[model samples]
Target chain A: MTTEKMIIEIKKWLMEAAGYIRVSLTNELTVSQKSGRTDLVTNIDEETQSFFIKKINQYYPNDRILAEEKGYDTIDSLTGRVWIIDPIDGTMNFVMEQENFCIMIAVFEEGIGQLGFIYDVMKDELYWGGKNRGVFLNEQKLAQPNDVSLSKGLLGMNAYMYGKNIHSAGEIGHASMGIRVSGCAGVELIAMLKGNHIGYISNLSPWDYAAGLVLLDEFGFKYSNIEGKPLTFTKREYFLAATPTAYAEILENFI
Target chain B: MTTEKMIIEIKKWLMEAAGYIRVSLTNELTVSQKSGRTDLVTNIDEETQSFFIKKINQYYPNDRILAEEKGYDTIDSLTGRVWIIDPIDGTMNFVMEQENFCIMIAVFEEGIGQLGFIYDVMKDELYWGGKNRGVFLNEQKLAQPNDVSLSKGLLGMNAYMYGKNIHSAGEIGHASMGIRVSGCAGVELIAMLKGNHIGYISNLSPWDYAAGLVLLDEFGFKYSNIEGKPLTFTKREYFLAATPTAYAEILENFI
Candidate 1:
């Protein structure tokens, strides 16, 4: 099938997943700590991932899967198509607030990112993009983000980034108009796409950021590790996502 | 007129103010900087304040008005009614994102907070309350927020609080589940009342937080200076607005 047909099929799968999520809000959720008490995973997270895995197998049985709850196999030669999924990106927010969380999916072929999808479940906003098509906010094509520096716009960040003084985040916190912490990487990415924030900076896992990289590329925003290296799907690292001017200001002055 | 009649009149005035705000969105806004380029004042802020002042003068000619955009005389001897208004609480958010801002109004009688309102304009959520009626989101009366400790819940703060490490904000930043920066005190107060946050900590001016104080008091949330003194409506100070456990934890450990 052509990529266009495949994308339509993927969106269908996503809608089905969202239906399960919205309908299951009242269902009892079982939550457990992962890396620590503060790091959490809920029963819905596993169920959502299972749903996507089932649909992917039914549609594209040969594709490899890299899911957050489950580990991924190394793509040493970058040969086959791989699907990266984070079922519910902000488990704590999901279990506690029942808000500000999303499902993220990214498709890559031969190690080059192709398509990305992020659905903010409660807000009903769908952000999708790829190189073949520019980024869109629910079918409305997004203009390139405003070229804002740190002083002129708000920045989204994780508290630990500043509390731990990583990469002089404290300085960046002081430099921006303000900071927003949504507790979900995909939600932050959607906010960035809408120009609600100049940028988002954090140490994120592959599942948290892989989907966003495609959208950021399509939107003409920049994303890279603090060391100024290109992002790779292989490992976790400190990454900076910023508009044109902020990318230069944060990279030069703070990052 | 009876106090009950007075409250109904206040609600009508608030609805009219909201109507004016909704209609003015398309008018070209003249923006200017205050303390800095990022500290903004827009034409709407002044106009909204003027609308309220005009309506108040037409209805209750003897009462006083204290607004963010203008100063007013104190009700000498604490004997007359005073309305405190923050015409556009998050001016930067309003001008840049056209969202995340609100109009706040509070009424005090003889120096005691009697009623308060914080309207999230874009979201169309109105939160209002007082000693007579308790707090509410739209029309639903809010239950007292969960008694979440600093370690188990999120905290809302001004960036400078954490960036400067004032009141041990860095330590509190580490202790909380996370932090959110909404860039508007009234919005943060509404978030806190809804239990999305354990509390809010910041250095806020009177108009920035007076409306919230009335609602917080009605909901049994606690507000105080960083030094654990009762808030004096007369000056700017580092303040803490908290749930039961967070009040204890932040007071005894962090603040």
Candidate 2:
């Protein structure tokens, strides 16, 4: 019943799920398209989701599930205990490189984030925390990244953002130390948490970033939609997750 | 000495230098700006070059060196035995993430690429070979990547390229499966070689791409400047390295 017990249980479950991904990585993967030719879905994505769904139904049946491949469109309420899961965040990266994709899950109770988990499968590094617990990478508690100015920090951006001149994403490109694109939302968000990148400018779906948003809030990061509005965990929007000073600099000069 | 004999000894030296880098990575690094605030030079960059210089001179004093930080910008000849070294290819990535950066070296004789070595330090994966022996990742000899079309491929691009539009880089974004940027030329080029990315488009100086070009050439990749000209290796130019079908498709549809 205790949050401490829940945290311990969640960590063990995450590591177990990650173990499945690692073992199956070398197996022949079946990949197909979603949305369009570029958007992809692999067998691993479906398998991982089924694994979580089966486990959750058996262990925590009452918890509402909003999973990427299934049950996402059916969610009309954020009430009760809701688990938002992105079984595989970077499916294309997974199908191709089999290196950068991740497994993400966020537990929310009555619309408040109770816990968040991001497992970088290839690296086996678990990033988890929310609210009172503070963010953590593996076991080490992370320190708050300083509010660095845009010019003093590198930016992790969506590659498409660079060409969308209307948003001044290209102008920000010239102002930062540099730009990097990892093609994975969970990994990019973790980079911002570690201070490897001061901010990430992106447009992502809910499953791609909900788990990361919880960790960002715990680390005191300024993350919001492009209009500087708070994320609602539903609709897709242009997102900016950043340190304070960096966020101000990007908004003032670039956006 | 035979080229075969030289390669055998040089691989040893490269691994030893990489060992030093691995050990010294955690030390306090002092960074200074070069060209502008964004371009950086760290003490490790200088130390690595010195380590290479001392070892090279001790082993082959008669050979010429054109290194990124030290002997670079002084080369009058590409003739004779010349070592083109980028002590650390992704300096900013090295300073920020302490990963994704690499040690790249290319050995040329009489304007011909004789041997090449790119050490992905954190992974301890060495991509090495030349005109004669063929490219190998670690001990595995790499086979040529299939000629996938542009629409089916992912392009690793310079984050800045997406905005330029001059090279139709943005158009290519729509044509490829997606665009990713690693902010490191050496690693990006390796990605292209492994088929994780079908191509890489960027404007890079010689040391930024030479060693990888050797590997690309051995792998039968088609690479050239934006105007479809050969790279002079003395100046920066927009470059494209891709599989056969992907190269042709990008050239026709986007370029």
Candidate 3:
């Protein structure tokens, strides 16, 4: 199948899987951590990840799978495709508030992202993208955000980034028009898609950036390391995604 | 009438007024600024403030009023009763996303806070408090937060605080469990009421703090200037609010 065809199939599968997972989340019982008192896991995260794995294996048995709750499974020498999944991002928000969390999925073929999806189940906002098709929120195509300077733009950043003094991300927020930390990277990415923010900077995992990176790339937004280099599949300590102009300004002044 | 009766009346009036304002926001036509750009001000904000002002006038003709959008107005000379109001806090959030904003009201008698109310319209959650009645989220009474140390607690703070290097609030966040900044002070205070966050520090106008201050006091949360002095009504700069234990920890290590 062509890359486009694969992405379309992935999008459909994501919608179906998200709906199932959301329903289950509403009814599933929660479990606390094995070590820490605060960390929690719900049956929904595991069940949802399993459901997606099952569907992906049924469709593309050769694809490698890496998930948050479930460890990596290597598939030898069949195809160079890997599915990265975060069944529930913002699990804390999910367990306590029942909102702000999402299911993220990304398919990379031969180390190039072929498809990406972030489903905000509670808000019913589906942000998806693929090679050549551009980014989309639901059916509407997303525009690259207006060319705003760092000082004039709104930024989505974690409050901890400021506290931890990570690469001056907090300083960038002070220089911006305003700062918003919504506690969920998936939800914050949606805000970026809607032009509510000019950029988002965070310390994120593969599952966190997999879907959003594709969407940012498709929409002509810039995503990079704090030093303005392109992001790789390897885990990164910091990533910055922004409009082209904002990215340039932030890189010049802070990075 | 007794103070309890007055608070109940104000709460009911605020709820009805919010419903009216919400409908107006949904239906009213908006116009752009002469600068030829979208300058958003929903009719809800104006109409809601007006509705509230009229209600206060009819019920307590002797009370003074201080409101956003329309500055302070003195109605009577002898009575030292004042109402601080923010018809719509988080107006940007309201105009852009139609969520996370709230109606905030606080009553002071003889220069002492007597009652406070914050209505989360979309979720139908009402947080209210008074000196004698304690704090409440809807009908449930709130207790003092757990005596978690700063290292074990979460904080609600503005992300820009770090960039500005103001009060070193970000450092305090680093010392905590994690940090969250929700953009809306009213919504953030709700998190504090639930013991989800130990404290919040922000640059706030009187309206923003008016309602939250009473709730914090009733729930045994302490608020003071960044220097650890009591908060005064006239200042708009740095202030810290935290559980007593967390406050002591923060003052010792971070402050």
Candidate 4:
């Protein structure tokens, strides 16, 4: 199928998924702790993942899936026709604030990103794009944010990392215009894409960064592990995404 | 005027002022530095303040005004009817992202808060209320948030205070579920009002905390200076506002 055609299909599915999630929000959510007390998942998250999986299987039968809730053990490498999904990127925010969480999906072929979608369900904003297609928020095309340096722009930070001063995260917060913590990787990436922040850093899993990395890349953002190494897409890693100058400054001075 | 009648009048003016600010956003903003580089003021801010002052002078000529841009020198005490205004809270956010900023107003009578209003321009959300009127977001009446403890909920923090670990701010952040910084006091207060955050701490002036404190008080929040004293509302002071449990916990354990 053509990229545009696939996007149209995916958008429909995403809107439907968001509708389900929104309706489910009015009902009681079955929440459970994941890695820790701070990490959480809800029944809605699981159902959303199932919704996406069922659609992909029904349509793209041969596409391998790696998602937050399931299918991770079945994928060993980023080989051909892989789909990465994070049904709910900010589960705690989902269960608590009912905002700031997102549904993210990225399609890859032979380790290259082909399409990406991050749906802020509550806001009804779908940020989606692909290689050579540029980027867009809902129906409007988005422009590339200015390449701002560390001192000139805000940074999105992991609350735990910033509080603990991990890797001098607090120092980096001081060096920038300031730091904002949204407690959601998807929301932070959205802020970065809108030029509200120059960079964002956090310990993120493959599902957490997959769709955002693709979208950010399309917007001319530089991203990698804190050590300036490429993400392996197989595990959780300390991640950083920023404009060129901020990325270089952070890697050289703070990280 | 009766309290209800005054609220209706204020709401009308707030909507009109918001309309003007929204229209001006499309034009080039006359931005200037205030106190430091991070502290900013724009022509819109000044114009909005002037707008409020003009209305107050025309309608309630005897009432005093304390606003961000002007009218501070003459108010020696809060002994009479007074209106405290932050025509544009989060001016930096306004000058940069154009979201998250708000116009805040608080009316006091005989040293007691009588009414409050916080209008989030971009989101078009108006959180307004008074002592005995109960709090509200737009037309919907809001309920008091759960009295969650420090360890159980998110905290809104000032980036500089959190980064510098001022008065153990970093330690407090670690004690909470997490911390969020929206770079805007009005936005943070809105989050706390919505139960998205349990607490918020920052150094603020009369205009910054005045409106929020009134609404928060209506919602059963506990607020005071870091030293556990009353806010004088005449100068910059270190402040904290939280649900009762979180406030007590932070004071007993972390502060």
Interface RMSD of each: 1.8, 1.3, 4.5, 1.4
Please give, as one word, the docking class of candidate 4. Answer: medium
Task: Rank by TM-score, highest first.
Answer: 4, 2, 1, 3
Mind giving the per-residue lDDT tens digits that candidate 4 earns over A21-88? 99998999998888888878788988899998999999999889999985452379888799999998
Off by over 4 Å in 1: A72-78, B2-9, B19-28, B73-78
Q: What is the C-alpha lDDT of each candidate?
A: 0.83, 0.83, 0.76, 0.89
CAPRI rating of model 3: acceptable
- Give the TM-score of chain A, superposed on the true chain A, for all candidates in the order listed: 0.95, 0.94, 0.89, 0.98
**DockQ of prediction 1:** 0.54
**Which 10-residue span in candidate 4 chain A carries the lowest summed lDDT?**
A70-79
Per-residue lDDT of candidate 3, residues A1-255 (tens digit)? 677677678777777777876676558566657335445667887878888889889988877887777465223331488888888887767765567788888887777777888889887888888878777888888776666677655688866575555798767876776678767789888888777778998877677888887787777788887787766555645888988989988899987
Error of 2 at B82 (Å): 1.2
DockQ of each: 0.54, 0.69, 0.30, 0.68
Per-residue error for A240 in candidate 4, Å, reads: 1.3
How is the predicted docking of candidate 2 categorized under the CAPRI scheme?
Answer: medium
RMSD of each: 2.2, 2.0, 5.1, 1.5
- Candidates 1 and 3: which is better by lDDT? 1
Best model number under lDDT: 4
lDDT of 4 at B121: 94
Model 4, B1-255: lDDT tens digits are: 688788998998899999999899889999888888777889999999998888888889999999999545236899889999999999888877878899999999998999999999999999999988889999999988999988889899987788778878888988887788888999999999999999999999999988998999988999999868999987888899999998888888877
Per-residue error (Å), model 4, residue A62 = 1.0
Which residue pairs collide in model 3, if any? none
